[model samples]
Each structure stands twice: as C-alpha cells, then as structure tokens.
Target: MSGSALKPATELARGNSVRTPNESAEYRRAREQLLAEEIELRRHIERVAELRRALPPGGVVTKNYEFEGEGGKATLSDLFGNKQTLVIYSYMFGPAREQPCPMCTSFMGTWEGKLPDVEQRVAFVFVARSPIARLIAAKKARGWTQHRIYSDASGDYTRDYVSATDADAPGYNVFTRRDGSIRHFWAGEMGPSTADPGQDPRGAPDFDPLWTILDTTPEGRGKDWYPRLSY
Candidate 1:
C-alpha cells in the first residue's frame, strides 16, 4: 500500500493476462476474483508494516545482559556491533532440551541464506540457553555459517526476554541503540491466544517462508504437522 506506484489493486487484477490452455470461463472469473483478493492481501501486508514502523519507542532495556559467544564474553550492547539496531532470536535450545526445538530450528535454518542481505541493515544474533560449545556444535551440524550465535549461559537474558519460567519457547525481539540509549523495538507478538480455532499460534506475515510457501499450495500448513529435526 505504501511502497511504489499507487495503482488500483483491483484494476491491476482485472488487467491480469495470466491464462491457461483450455481454461473455462467460470475458472477465469473465479481466478480474477482470487487475484483481486491476493492484491488486496499484499496491500494489507504493507499497511501493517507501515503501522509497525510508526510505533512509538518501546521500553528501555534496563539490564546489560551477558552472553557467551565465539569471541568470549559479550553483552547486549556488544551484540549491536556497527549497526544501530539488533535483532535477537531467542531460540528454544535451552539446557533442558535434548535437542533444539524443531520449530525454532526450522525457522533459523531458513534465515541462513538471507543472513548476508539482512545483516546489511541490522545486527542479527541467535541466543540460546545452552552453553556456547553446545550451540556451536549445533550450528556446525546444521551448516549455519552466516548468522552470529551466542549462549545465554546465565539465563538472565532468556528469563527476561524469552520466557520467565521453564516452559521454554521461541521468541523474536528487536532492540535499537539510538542517541546513546538502548531500547526495545518490535517483536513477533502473535501467540496461542491470538490463533484462530484449529490453527497454530503464528506471527502475521509469517517469519518463516516455509509456511508462506506452503500457504500457496493445495495442501496448506496443516494444524497438526510441524517441522522435525529429522524425518
């Protein structure tokens, strides 16, 4: 809605030239309607992103959370590197889990290819409660070469930002350092309570392209099916 030329989405759909061999008139009519909706959906996504960008400043980060990284000790501020903003993924690889959460793994795995492009603007880091060595092992196993990762060895950062208790879950948090002050930015706020009946809790504009890609297929992301570490 906000970006590029403001062409009428419905008009664009009406002018669509896509046609299949031997397609029925009824099918074309229905497809045109679907295309209109799809265009509207794209506009709606841009509108939501516009609103998200306009949000007022979020809470100030009060603590200097520590983490263990490849370069030894680091703090929340240190993660920002040269960028003004930092995006931290609180993955569910806490010490208690036998393996990292499959869902989280699936999500992070998708990010691997995009890291080079994404890190150009914001510093992206992956945080887990497991020790640095264990996390490094997992990263190597997964062939994740681009994203920076660290261990919330003390669980302080995890408890404050990820979850307060033992029910470890995956979370995405954004932080910004502006004018010598560090503050919280947007986060993926969608969760169980926001889910439609029979649908899993998921963020809008789905962070994982896996779900978005599946949504275009005949078989959508089923409610019960989920990613696994292994087949």
Candidate 2:
C-alpha cells in the first residue's frame, strides 16, 4: 500500500529496503555521537602524551653503584654497555621474596622477544635487587640471553631511581644526557596497577590494548599464565 509496506523478503535481502526519514536521521545521530566519542578519546591521548613530554628533567645519581655482570664486576654505566640512553626496569626478584613476581615475569617475557628491536633505538636492561649469582641463575633459567641483565645487590641504584623504597617493585626508569650531565626522564612503578583496570572490581574502565588483545581469544592469557624459567 504505502512505500513503507515493502515485502519482508525484500527488506531482509537488501538491508536498506525501507527506512523512514526519521530512522535515517536517528542512525546519523548515533553515528555522530560515536564519532564525537572517538575524537574526544584521541584528544585525551594527545593530552597524556603532552604531559609525558612536559615532565621536568630529573636529578642524576652522582655515586656509582656496583653490579655483577656475566663478565664479572661492573658499574652502573656498564649496564648502559656504551649505549647513549639506558632504560632500566626494576624487577621484583629479591632474596627474601616468596617467588619472582608473575606480572613482572610476564612483562619480561614480552621484552625478551622485543629486546632486539628496542636495542636499535635505546639500550634496555633489567635490574634486580638480588645477588649477582642469584640474578644470573634466574636469567639463565628463564632463557633471557638476548638482553643485558644485572643485579643491584645493594639497593643504592634502585633507591636513586625511586623504583624501590627499601623494597623493590616492578618499575621502569629512563635516563638520558642533557648537556654534560645525566638526567632522569621518566619512571613508572605502578604501571601494573595502572594497566589492569579490571582489578578495580567496581566499574571496569576500557581495558588496556595489551590486555584486550590477549582477551580476544578463547584460551586467553589465563590467570595461571606465568613465565617459567624452563619451558
């Protein structure tokens, strides 16, 4: 009868067989809202990037800290291993701890494969506040041979970087040279907490891209997922 009374099969076969002007307008409005939300999200990301760039230069550590390397004794600079900039991640693996932290281990597992690509841009190292022998054993067990590993047996360097408080936590610190002096650029200890919004248990924020990617499959990186020294 009316133009709106199209055959059901026709409507089903051609998705746009019949739509009132009002329906089209409502669809456009919904699309505009989604686009606006995307734009706002992009703006928020840009703001966060600006804040990261605006961080003030940090103080340098004047005192040299000693570490044990595969080659024997080494200094903090040795961790750099001649790279211009050093990115150190403080791993939560100390002597007294019950076990090596699983979250840190997971992060390190990702790093193991990524180290070669990253080393091309900047030097990367993992520092544990454990004995050199203990740290080396862990590295060997985990098959982490591509990247440099060191032990800050004494907590001096860990404290200097603010990655540890008398006790070490999983954290990352970046250092660079400004003029003739070294300066800290960025540090993050609470990254795990920040990245895992699902931990809130109240209202879940948009999940992190890393977690979301892992979540797209049936097996998913399960809770029992952990890095093993020997796999």
Candidate 3:
C-alpha cells in the first residue's frame, strides 16, 4: 500500500498498551514518539525493497567466470543450481592473507544458521580469492556445515564484481538466470565514498545483526572496535 493511503504512524503508535514498571510520563511520551519514527522507518524500508524488486533487467553476464567449489570446477552459471536467482558473497579471504577478514567471518557466521531457510528461495554461496583447499579449511575450522564455499582462484570474478584490483573485500552480489540468459541483478554498492560522517559504510537495512543488537544498548557500535577471528 502507498504511504498516502495508510494511517499516520503517530496515530497508530498512540494505540499501544505497552507499559513498564516505574516508568515516568516523560519516558513514555518519548518512547511513543520514537515508536512513531520507527514505524515510519519500517515503511521507508518497505518502499525501498519495492523499488529494488521493480528494477528492469540488469546487464547480461557474458563472461563465463570459473570457480573451484567443494565438488569440483564450476562456472558462474553452475552456481545457480536449480534456482532462478543466485546470491554470492565475495569473502575477504585472499591468498596473501594468513586469515580471512574477521568482519567477513562474523557476517557469514550470522548467515550460517539461516542458510537453510534462505536457500529455499535462492541459491546462496560464498566465494573467495583463495584456493579451494584453504576456503574449505576455514569453513571446517569454523564448524560451518551448510555454507557452500567456493574459490575464485583466478580472480576473474573477484576483479569484475568485488574489486577491480582483486583486493580482499567483502561483496554481496545477486544474479538471475532467466530464459537461458544470466544477468547481474543487484549488488551492495555502498562503500567509503557513500559513508556518512563519523560512521562506517554499511549496507542498507544493515545485513549484520550484531550491530543491530548492539544499537539497542547504551554502548552501541562504537568506533575502534571490530570482530576478531577468536577471543
């Protein structure tokens, strides 16, 4: 439904029966106001998703990018399996690094458990600019059983989608296969250039739940702090 056709968020927020012990009138008033803003934020998110879904056909992917999967050598089209859509996460694990980026590891960890549900709708896999053996070893070390890890050994796919220099950076790209033609659907384009003042560049609706959970606390996602491979 359009925003204009719906009731105002403030009016909807006023009908809540939420109450807390020892809460002052001022706190309740402020919370209710915040609730209205939150409702509006949710509506905006829905609108953005609608826009994304309405996009026209993306660029055709003519290059047959090669990758090494757990099974064996495969092409980009092979990653789609039986699904019409494919979601690939370019993991920041290059051959030059001893360990993968902690941030990427943390992000994938959040999705590990949810893959089964997500895969029901689309084929999802993780690709890295490292050897297949190393990628498999990292997956095993993390005790991840469901994540489909692959190696973009030649860096062709990485250079085209993730980074031009084939740098170790996290990338989220979506592709669609329709009528025997594969095309780039969408990708997370937000980066250093898109970052706001005093904040790191992040995907819209923020894919990471860690930051969302921390945002509710007084100590939120502070500067100078990041995830680590191990404690």
Candidate 4:
C-alpha cells in the first residue's frame, strides 16, 4: 500500500478507538447548540403571536348588512348571535366562480370538525360574497352541517373588515370586543405559509398540531393530499 494509504482493517481499528472525555464534551456542546437554535425558533414564533395580539382595533361597522340564514333573514349582529367574540373566515366562493375554491373547502372541512369545540369558546362562521342561497347549497353539497354559514351578498361586511379585494378576495379575520366596541383582532390571506405546492391542501400552516402529529409517522401523510367531502 502507498505510504498515505491505509487498508480497510487498519482504518477500522483506528475508527473503533474510544473517545476521550474532552471529545465527549465537545459532542455535547454541539448538541447544546442545536437545542439552543430550536429554543430560539420557538421564541421567535411566540413573538409573532404577541404582535398579533397587540394589533390596534380597526374601522367600525357603520352599515349593517343582511344575510339569509337557516331560520330567515339575519344581520351582521346575527352572526355574533349573543356571543362576545366572533371569527369570520372569508371564503373565496362568489357568484361567478365555477366552483368553491379547493383550498377554502379544505379549511372549511377542518373548521367543520372543530365547530363544536370552537363554539364552546367563541362564535365562528364562514362568510362568502355569494348570495345566501348559493352559499347554503354549496355547504349542503359538502355535507358541512355543523357550522353556521353566511353570505356577504352586499359585500359591505367583507369590505369593512378589509378581507375583501376590489372584487372579492378570500381571507380569514378575527374580531373581538373591548368596552362594548367591536374590533378587528387578526387577519390572514391565502399565501405561501397557508397554501402552496408541497403543502397541506387545507391551505393552513405546517405548524398546525394535526399536521405536526401526522408528520411523525413512517408513511408521513404522503404528498398526495386532498380534502374529502364525502368518504
């Protein structure tokens, strides 16, 4: 063998040598560095959440809009339905769209499953720019009977909340009250973090506990993802 070359047996013998205490200490330091990075990442996320909570209240609702509900005609206040807080998810469905946006459909599915739990804490409803009849038809077709749905046919409510585009933009907004005044709390639009290639079809964050838990499995909730309306 060349002077610089070592046989496999010789290399194995050296590689099997025991590590010294100092070497183990260095390894532990590397591990600690990785742990520190994880802790820092968590802190950054928490900071963003705090900022969301700190957002100042926005415009007040000067106009009361009408909507058709399961019972009959309802107003914006009907959505709150005596609840102190409200969460409005502005779905993308409109009169012109051929079908409901798939991403919105997936999110609605998740919301449907969580409706009971959410109602126990705060009121929640899905809003769309389409007429009430159209919105209700879509919901029935999807078998989404759990949560309340509303129509922003007049578009006034969506526009006032900053969730609607010049035409119609899909968004999710949260609202709460302070000293008897309703206020905007949070708003989210469909984007890379919510929807993109190689992401959940529900168009939600990868940080969702449901997705995180599924990621730990061997098969890992494979890439072929879509929400099922039935079955």
Candidate 5:
C-alpha cells in the first residue's frame, strides 16, 4: 500500500449483515463496505445543509406580493404565519395548461404527508399560476389535506422568483420575515446548465424520496419515466 493511503471506513463500521440462506461472505463484505459509505454520506448531507444555512442572507424581498388561497387574498407576510422562516414551492401549474406538470405534482405529493412535521420548524406552502379554485380542486383531488395551495393570479411572484417571462417552472424559494421586513433566504438554483450527463437538473442531496428509493432498484429511475396524476 502507498504510504499516503488510508483505510476505507468499512473497517470502523459496526454494521452487521443479514443471515439469509443465500447470502455469501462476499456479499456481507460488500454490504458492510457500502454501510460505511452510507454513514459518511449521511454526515456529508448534514454538512452541506449546515453550509447552506450559513450562507449570508439572500436578497431583500422588495415586492409585497399577494396571492389567492382558499380563504381569499393573502400577502407574502401573511404566509409567514408565526414562523420566521417560510418556504414557498412555486408549482408548474400555469393557467394555460389543462393539467399541472406531473413532475411538480409528484414533488408536491411527496411533501403532503410530511408537511405537518416540516411546519413545526418552518412555514411551508405551494404556489401556482392557476386560479385559486383550480389549485384547490386539484389539491383536494389529490387528497392532500395538510398543505395549503395558493395562486399567483397575476404571475407577479412567479415572474420575480422563477422566470422573467412567467414560464411554467418549479421553484423552491425560502424567505425570512423578521423585524417587520422580509428577505429572500435561498432558492434551488440548479438547472439544465448544472445537470450532469444522463441526469436531470437536480440539486445536490436530492430531497425527493421517490428518486432516492428508485435509485436503489436495478431498473433505477429510467430517463423517460415520470409521475402521473392518475394510475
């Protein structure tokens, strides 16, 4: 071994292998090694999250945007709801589309069950360009009872945070409301330019459990497959 070489973390892992009838020594060794890597990967994810939290406060939100929800009009400040941090997911459901983007719907569906736990630390909501009634109907149809959907009827917020021309796109924007002022915190900036070959444009440490789960299978997430609204 080279003088500079270090042992892989597998040596330090306490993970054990299953005693399945067909399991082999080689399989145990490989799994134990992967366990060590998984441990390190988890730590790495937290470190990246910490770094993201440490970023200097992002741009100050100058526009006092208003949106329509189930109860009527609500300004950006109203969305903050008692929490200092607010996360708004700009969904890709433009007024012109007969249906919302399947990808965005899939993403939103993932968060439905987790919203209650997530909101304990941060306020969260979904925004789309569709009318309030349309957005509400879709949410109900999807059986998403936890989240509140809103409409950027004027496309003002969508244009400002997502696309300059009001293109149908998905955006993850975070903001901070403090001392009577609100400021942008961060947004998922990864896009086509940052995409690796054969992969879609996605942020590091992909938050989607669906993709993560599919990645563990032999078929993997094929290039053409995507979530559907029905069946």
Candidate 6:
C-alpha cells in the first residue's frame, strides 16, 4: 500500500477512541491526538520498509569466508543451505569474553523460538568469533535448540563483514545468491555513533520484543537497566 493512497492519519485517528472508567474529556482529547501520531508512525515504518526492499543490487561477495559449524568446516555459501537468501547474526560472543554479551543473549533469546518460522523463507544462522564448541556451549546454556550457531575461529569473516577491526561487537548481515553468485544484501548500520542523545544504539524496527514491550511502559527502556544472563 502506498502512503499517498491512505486516508489522512488524523482523519483515521479521529474515529478511534478508548473508553475508560471516569476518563475526563481533556484526557480523551489528548489520547486522540496521540493516536494520530501513532497512525503516522505506522505509515512511516511501512514507507521505510518499502524503501529498503527497493534497494539496488549490493556488492558481490568475493571472499570465501570459512566457519566451523556442528558438521565441521563450512563456507559462506554453505551457510545458505538450500535457500537463496541467508541472514547471519554475528553476536558479541568472542574468544576473549568469559560469557556472551547479555544484550546479545537477550536478542537471540527472542529469535530462538521464531527461527523455525523465519527459516521457511530465509536461511538464518548465528555466528560468533569464539570456537565452535564454545558457541555450542552457550547455546546449550541458554536452552536454545533451534538456533544454528557457527564459529568464525579464523576471524576472517568477522573482520571483513562483522567488524573491520574484528571487535567483539554484534552485527546483522544479509546475503543473497543469484545466478550462482553471492552478494551482500543488507546490514544493520545503526550503532553507538549514530545513537541519539540519552538512548543506546539500536536497530530500526528492533527485532527484540523486550525493548518494544518496554517502550509501551512509562519507564521506556530505563537508562541503566540491561538484561542479565541469570536474573
């Protein structure tokens, strides 16, 4: 659906209402105003998605990056399995960290259950700079049975795609295979440098329901609070 074909957000919002016990007329009016903005926000989100889907061809992948999975050595092309598109989430679980990043763990937790559904359309896997055994251990610790995790033990793939310096930062990258050639498709570009004042770096249309649910509360993703491995 195009934004131009839609009714004015304000006009649509005007017809919506929330009734509550003894709600004042002033409160109701303000609620309606907020509703209008929400409608506009929804439209804006769809517009951004449309723009992303329409992006031109991305750069072709030349490196035959290798990783270690459950079945041993595998190349980038192998990660795609039988699918044409692959989504790799490079988490901040490097050899140096005694434990995986709490934030990354939180993010992966949300996708653990949904991977089965998502894989029906695109091949999805989790990659980390740690050894294959370590990555598997973390998966077991989290009780994640559905996520396909791999180890970029050589750090070649991490340095080239996840981080230029091979830092232990989280990354989200997508690739596509066409005509027997692989190409980098999209990646999460927002990071610490792009974060707004008083907010942490986050992806647009954040895949984590944790933050989304927090956003609906009055606290609004509290300043210092973060997920813990065990709490």
Highest-TM-score candidate: 3
After superposition, the stretches of candidate 3 with alpha carbons farther than 4 Å from their true spots are none
Better of 2 and 5 by TM-score: 5
Off by over 4 Å in 6: none
Segments of candidate 2 deviating more than 4 angstroms: 1-43, 189-212, 215-231
Error of 3 at 144 (Å): 0.3
Model 3: which residue pairs collide?
Answer: none
Report the lDDT tens digits of candidate 1 across residue range 85-158.
99999898888888999999999999888999999999999998889999999999999899699999888887
Better of 4 and 6 by lDDT: 6
**135 Cα displacement, candidate 3 (Å):** 0.5
Task: Rank candidates, TM-score, best first.
Answer: 3, 6, 1, 5, 2, 4
**Residues forming the 10-long window of minimal summed lDDT in candidate 5:** 1-10
lDDT per residue as tens, model 3, 21-83: 999999999999999999999999999999999899999998999999999999999999999
**Which residue pairs clash in candidate 6?**
none
Deviation (Å) of 31 in candidate 1: 1.0
lDDT of each: 0.90, 0.67, 0.94, 0.68, 0.87, 0.92
Report the error of model 3 at residue 75, Å: 0.9
lDDT of 4 by residue, 1-231 (tens): 132342343344334444556567667555556555545555556666777777777666556678766667787666777787788877778889877887568667766777899898888888887887888889888888896888777777777674436356667677776577676667665565656577644533342444556766767777876555345
- Score every model by TM-score: 0.95, 0.67, 0.98, 0.66, 0.91, 0.97
| lDDT, residue 80, model 2 | 66
Regions more than 4 Å wrong, model 4: 1-38, 162-166, 189-231
Q: Model 5, 1-231: lDDT tens per residue?
A: 231354455655654534567888897777787888886787677778888889987889999899999999999999989999999999888889999888888988898879999999999999999999999888888888998889999999999999999999899999998788799998999999999998888887887889999989989989999888889
Better of 1 and 3 by lDDT: 3
After superposition, which runs of candidate 1 have C-alpha atoms over 4 Å from their true positions? Answer: 1-7
After the best TM-score superposition of candidate 2, give how far the Cα of residue 106 lies from its true spot, in angstroms: 0.9
Residue pairs that clash (backbone atoms under 3 angstroms), model 4? none
Model 6 lDDT tens row, 38-142:
998898888898898888989999999999998899999999999999999999989999999999999999987799999999999999999999999999999
Clashes of each: 0, 0, 0, 0, 0, 0
